[model samples]
Target: MKDVQKVLDWVVAEVGVPGIVAEVKDGGRSWFGTAGVADLETGAPRQQGECLHTGSSGKAFTAATILALEAEGRLSLDDTVEQWLPGALNVNGYDGNTITIRHLLSNTSGLFSTGLAPEVAQRYATRAGFRRHRFDAYTLQDMLKLAVSQPPVGAPGERFTYANGGFHLAGAIIEAVTGNSYADEVETRVIQPLGLADTYVRPAADISYPDPHPKAYSKMFFKDGTDLATLTAENWESLLEDPGLAPMDVTEVNSSGAWSAGNIISTTSDMIRLVDALAAGTLLPPAQHRHMWTTVSTEGGYWMPHARYGLGLFEFDKQATGGTPLRGVAGSLWGSWFFAIGTADGRHTMAVHTNTEWKSWDVLFKLIHAAFGLTIGA
Candidate 1:
């Protein structure tokens, strides 16, 4: 235990992070700890209930939303994209009928990175102007316009490309089938049911936090330099509202871009709760839960064994420091990290969140190593 504490202390000291919250539970025993500040500028310490951006981690939620809808017989996993949102594809020789919900969920859809275009960047820059007006008014149709405009990077289901637009389309499908907004559907199907009070599908431009939060930073490399660190202020407000703030040139593809991909926000504890419930089969039925753990082959042929797309969760397995098997899905963004890990028997579970964008995984793996009496990186 002292060694674990020492490792945590070293992470806080060496990473210059704002804060970190961690919890470990095994055989009815649990250890929870925190280090650093929730808000560095204000000197507020980190806590268990604080929220952080989960980035791609929200993909799990989006997946779960679809599953919940499926469970209700509102839709099916095999449903094609064109079936719900007609005329969603404008790309030459490509029809929406070729894209399926499974393709989107598995990231096998051929949609390219919405962030790759220059125009998208400009529109995101003017987010402040959009927020001044009604932000939620933006609809899924608006998102499809941008998606249809982009040509397929590959044949549908040809490979895994990690496209955010695919998830956006999935969210749009959910909205169309359920007659409710994607956010509301998520709230009804996942958040409210799970009692995840701290989780929400926040608009990109809403910057107000109920409590102290860590500042996000990004490091971009230009032709002249490397390691150029730039701070991303709660600029999400502007980015979501106005496309002008986006680094991409496409403006019309703002909020919809995140869609089911990276739009959800959650706290460390809430993330743990969600994952725990998922692993314990508290949400989906046994068969559906097993389906969620199914792994899809990637183009690179490297099995994402640690990660497999479920209805709405990505299952992962990690070898801890003590040689104990740990499993959990991790979410990350500019300066935040969220993850939960435990053994398959549900004997041990750990939840960790960090405000600083530093690489907490290294420290986490190390701590696990120490806990299991294994060598570092073993």
Candidate 2:
């Protein structure tokens, strides 16, 4: 099998993904690699140990905290979200009282996900728009209001629509149950226990990534007249293959639009640690652990192909038949497209990311194929 560094360099040179970093670990042995530029202006190369926003990848931590509290008999997944947060779900044609904690985690809550909405998504989706509001402050309430304006995907448990609003609502439940901030609970339960010093759930106002990190770049274009929201992976793949567009330097944007939904920051090494612990059942007890792993098919290919969402972590099985599972959470925010994958046994973990925005999910799949020697479909 090709080594990680060789493949990483190939990706940068041949595949045109800027500033990539990756790591694979098994049996206490590991390999790390980096390629492309960290800062396009300074021409600094990407490196290991530099922090990147993990995006929705941090939702796994949020999910773990909720499960830990449940293990302590503090709450139940079946508990109505309305029971905890009353008026927060005033979204069009939706009732928070009918949604459960499980619904939120599994992304069956049907809430409108503002993370993908035109008003919010367009702000950072294009070079022109991205440069306009890269440092704008977006409050949690401001984001939720967007979801509130949109309609639900379906009745709770009847459909799967991944929503940032749902997870932030989940974080609110965490605060309500624990009487501590969401960051505090995760710090005590996951970060401190695992000795992951680099991991942190960034607040809405914080607009900086950690030191030595690569600047993220992004591409934004469409076949003139195409609806931005309806642009699928097929069209996006075509756009990248025939690039008559400019990519944006998106290194310093605030993550407040994602907030608790996807605003955590950490390195690839620490991400592997988090994935290993979660998969090995070290983070949650047997019962809660099983609950966390009980995944439901996403049943759509808008973002990921053949995807499934578990409690917090998500996975994608590339084949129609049972293929190797790329199990871990992936995050897409600004210029980062990251995935931290592990096996069912919690061993043999690999994480890879390209510090470029709007790269296809295929970038993640190919990195997994390289790191683990697994076959991935087109």
**TM-score of each model, in listed order:** 0.75, 0.90
**Model 2 Cα shift for residue 233 (angstroms):** 9.4
Off by over 4 Å in 1: 1-4, 90-93, 120-142, 146-150, 203-205, 215-257, 298-312, 317-327, 345-347, 358-361, 367-378
- Which prediction has the highest TM-score against the true structure? 2
Overall local distance difference test of candidate 1: 0.61
Q: How much is 6 displaced in model 1, in angstroms?
A: 3.4
Q: Which stretches of candidate 2 lie over 4 Å from their true place?
A: 1-3, 221-242, 318-326
Give the best candidate by lDDT: 2
Error of 2 at 294 (Å): 0.5
After TM-score superposition, what is the CA distance of residue 83 in candidate 1 from its true location, in Å? 0.5
Q: Ten residues in a row with the worst lDDT in model 2?
A: 233-242
